[model samples]
Structures are given as C-alpha cells and as structure tokens.
Target: MGSAREALLDAAYEAIVAGDWTGARMADLAARAGVSRQTLYNEFGNRDQLVAALVLREAERFRALTGQAAREAPGDVGDATAAAVTAALTAALDNPLIKATLTDDTSGLLPYLTTRSAAIMDVFREDSIAIFTERWPEPAEHPEVRAEVGWISETAFRLVISHLIVATEPVETTSRHIAEVVRRLMRDLTTT
Candidate 1:
C-alpha cells in the first residue's frame, strides 16, 4: 500500500510481463522500483513472498473491478452477474500480466491463477458472499440458505476461472449463459 511497496510490486509485475517470472531478479526489480535490494527484501522478505504478494494484488484488483460492475449493472441478479463476468473477461483481455501468461504457456505463473488459487478464490469468495447476501438477504436462522449461497458463489467463481483459462464462446454469450445458470440456481434455492 505504501508507495515504495507498490512500486516494488509494479516493478516485479513489469518484469514478469516483459519476460517470465523465472528470469525476474530481485536486484533488477529493486532497481526498477528505484529502491535498494535491501529495501525490496525488507518489504517482501524474499522472492516467493514477493511473488505471492504480486499475484494476490492482481487477484484483488480483478475482484474489485468485477464487484463494481455487478453493483452497477441494471435489471435483476442475473443481469448483475452477467455484467460481473463480462467485466472480468474484458479486464483479463486488457491485463498485461494475463496476456503475458497466456502467451507464454511455460511461464510457471499459471499455478497462481489455477491450482494455487486459494488466495485468489478467497478474495472473490468474500466479495461474492457479500454480494449474494445483499441480493438475497437470507436470515441467520436459515443456515441452509446461507450454505447454498456459499456453494453458488464458489460455483460461479470456478465457472469464471474456467472461462478465463479456456474460452469456448464470445464473452457476451459466455457471460449471459453463466448469468442464466446463476439465476436458475438461485431460483431453485428459493423454490426449495
């Protein structure tokens, strides 16, 4: 959050974008950030920690962007969910890190977005739960409803992630379909 820390993360991100994470050096990143190597180490502890920080930051950024989209979307829950997915896909297309990762299949950064995605998932899960709660307003006594919402949130997140990694359709079509699925799931929950 501090300027120095943010700068270091930016530098690290730029390095990863320019080439791959394996080629990124702590010293080079420090220089790019206009900070000493010691400063970078002090801020991030080590390379792995720095990498995690960078990945988590990007995940948080994605969540924030998509959350805003869902909030601003018109119509009902289905429409908002569609907007969120659309925003996510659009943002991914414009993200340099995502572009680089996709182009360089061997970047080894895919784990951050895939298998090792717990932190990223957690970020989205929290936001999704809040949004779901706001839209549905399940009472505290209705633990089953809350559990259903949590399941839906995770399902939606996995769907989004799947689309990000492997696009089979247009963004609009994919988002609309995802929204429909979400709406149907919510409808089922309400009806039962």
Candidate 2:
C-alpha cells in the first residue's frame, strides 16, 4: 500500500468526485483508505487541511505531466511551450476537480481552486521560473534578465490558465496561438 497520507488523499479525491466536498466525513474517508479516523486526522488535521493536501497533490501531478509533455516536444522553446500548454488545457477539461472549477459551484470548493489560489499560484510561479531559466540560461547571468524572464514565464502560464477558465476556442487552436505568441516574445527577448 502507498503511504497513509497518499491513501487518505486518494480516497478523499474519490469521495469528492463521487459525492460532494462536504459530504465526505473523516470516518468515511478513513474507512475508504483502510485507516482509522485518527490516522486521517494525523495525516491531515481536518477537512480544510485534507482539501489543501488534495489540491496540492493534484497540482504536482499535473505539473509532472506537463513537464513530460514539454520534454517530449522538440527542444525549441515555442514547440515545447505550445505542446505543454495544449496537454495541460486538454487534461484540465477532463479533470474532475478542474471541470468542477469551471462548472458553477457544485462541489463547494470551486472558489478554493479558482479565486483563492495562493498555494496554486506559488507552485506555478516556481515552475514557470524554472522552465524559463532552464530554456534560456543567459537570463540567469543578470538580475534584470532573470526578473524579466520570470515575469514572462509567470504571465504566460497565467494567460494559458485564463484561457482555460474562459475557454472560447479549441485547445489545439488556442495553445498553438499562445505558442506563437511565446515564440515571438522569446525571439524578441533574444534579439534585444
């Protein structure tokens, strides 16, 4: 079996998906994970803590998937960025939690995933900064360049997420277009 912490979170996700956020009780969750209520509590204190862990775990899993997509694309920045974004947006459309976020407020936790996204933002910020610096290491040499790259990376990630939130077109088209935008931006940066 996996760690009790992961088992609890996995059960929690299943419960939330099968039912509602508020419906999953500590005892029920423990039963699903084959752990005691105290074990669940010890792993995650309370419902709020459990939810936070769930979201964080989901985010990290998404990030890993996204990184894999990016790596599989051609080494070029634009190609990788576009490919990663397309995969992420496509996956988000099918993701239960992310889909719940887009649909009204059924789960009672959409706001936590969307508007109240401090922890999520921090994850994206760090991931974006790392992606940028890795692709264009010259930025690492200068504080100003590093800041600018950081801004570009974070802004790009936000724009892609915003597109997901306000999805108007197909993932293929939007991600492709954004990739071009990124290419242009990075090209300009290299030229300057």
Estimate, for each residue in 18-44, the C-alpha lDDT of model 1 and write its tens digit.
884677678988999999999999999
Question: Model 2: per-residue lDDT, tens digit, 25-141?
Answer: 799999998999999888888988888888888878778888788777776667778888988898898898777556736566666656766676676666666766676666677
- Candidate 1 contains a number of clashing pairs equal to 0
Instruction: Name the regions of candidate 2 deviating beyond 4 angstroms.
Output: 184-192
The runs of at least 3 residues in candidate 1 whose Cα sits more than 4 Å from the true structure, single-residue gaps closed, are: 138-141
The deviation in Å at residue 151 for candidate 1 is: 1.7
Local distance difference test, per candidate?
0.84, 0.77
Give the 10-residue window scoring lowest on summed lDDT in candidate 1: 132-141
Maximum-TM-score candidate = 1
- Per-residue lDDT for 135 in model 2? 68
Give model 1's TM-score versus the native structure: 0.91
Candidate 1 has an lDDT of 0.84
